[model samples]
Target: MNGRSIATSAMLYTVTAATLVFIAAPLLVTMSLSVSDTQFVSFPPRGFTLAWYGKVLRDPDFQSALSFSLWLASFATFGALVLGLPAAFALVRFPVPGGAAIRSLLLSPLIFPVLVTGLGLLQLFSMLGWGSVPVNLLIAHILVTSPYVVRTVSASLMLADITLEEAARTLGASRWRTFRRVTLPQIAPGVAAGGLFAFMVSFDNYPVSMWLADAQNDPMPMFIYRKATGVFDPSVATVSTLLIGLAIVVVLILDRLVGLRRAMGM
Candidate 1:
């Protein structure tokens, strides 16, 4: 290779290595702290033990928060898919007036500050006299997660082969039939990717859950935040490490089912 090409390749490798270390360092420290035999979060743990993990496992508040988080994420992903798929179809298939504006509005949550969205939802719920905490969380999570579904489905739809749909139509297939047999299969990977993204977003959500949660119904992120800021225990590290492990497992499963490159629209 030429000198210039070698220089560019060296620069890219250095940047990639730096980026990976930057991201992984904190997580590695947290994992180490979780296994350390220390009362407080200390680097270079005095000794290694799994007591912190045991403590987190037995904590009732943690259990409740985890259960609530799982349910909320599941509900939010389902709702996002239901609401977003139709919106995606309309935006992609139909050339409505101000179509770009409508699509932007649908995806505004991704760009808008999450705190602002949470506060706005709080006000809306207060005005409507909605006292149901779980229901409010469900709505907030749906609002945040729906954009992932719309964006992914829109990309999939854009890449889809229109000739197949045309051929199906020419064969006397109904619109719904064509969608189910032809279009749905083509976009299924995108839908699955979107659903996974939505679920992960809702699961780890804190700002919106913080605004909506009551004393009795804290989500996992809120629970973790309180534990980290209030008590500052290594048990929190254990919980975090476990969650990170879960997230990694989920990503591996997704990569197994759909090529990660395709899922990311790369």
Candidate 2:
């Protein structure tokens, strides 16, 4: 390549590396704090000990929060799959009569701040006589998480060949049958990708949990926030690490299934 082109490419690579480091810095800091033997959060932990990890593992509160986060994330992912898959299909297949508007409406959650969405849902729940903590979490999670599923499934639909679907419909198949027999297979990867994102969104959720979680039984994020605010506890580090570990595991699974690098348009 020409000298100028090479220089530009090198600059871009340097910028990208810097960006990645910036993004990962906080997580690294948290991990460091979690392992610190000092009374306060510190870099270069005074000395490392597995005591905090043991404490976290032994604590019932942490265990419950962990379980609560898992099941809630799983349920939210299921809700996203059920609702988002059909919405995605409709948006892509028709692409008519304000399809863009309809798509926007479905994905409006992405535009709203998470705190606003959670607060809005809390208000709606209070009005509807379903203002319990669990109910609010469920509604908030479903609303926030569905957009990922829609984006994934929609992308997959756009990527796939139109003829494969047309051929299935031509064989005297019901629309549902055609979808099940043809479209489903092609979109499965996208659906799985979306589901993974939904899981992470629900699992890592902060704002919603702060507003909607029960005073007595907060989800993991809320639990972490509480611990962080009340005092510096190294066990909080274990919880943070565990949550991030779950996210990493999900990314690895997605990569194995469909390569997250490709999904990110990289």
Alpha-carbon deviation at 103 in model 2, angstroms: 1.1
- Put down candidate 2 lDDT per residue, 1-266, tens digits, no spaces: 99999999999999999999999988888787777776666656788877787888898888898888888999999999999999999889885789898889889998988898888877787788885677678778989999999998999899978898888888888899989988888777788888988998998898887777786657888888888888776777778887788788878878897766665556
After aligning candidate 1 to the native by TM-score, how far in Å is the CA of 207 from where it should be? Answer: 1.4
TM-score of 2: 0.91
> Would you list the clashing residue pairs of candidate 2?
none
Which residue ranges in model 1 land beyond 4 Å of their true spot? none
Question: What are the root-mean-square deviations of the candidates from the true structure over C-alphas?
Answer: 1.3, 2.0
The sequence of per-residue lDDT tens digits that candidate 1 reaches over residues 28-53 is 98998899887888778779899988
- Range of the 10 consecutive residues with the lowest summed lDDT in candidate 2: 257-266
Candidate 1 lDDT score at position 22:
94
Q: Which ten residues in a row have the lowest lDDT in candidate 1?
A: 257-266
TM-score of 1: 0.96
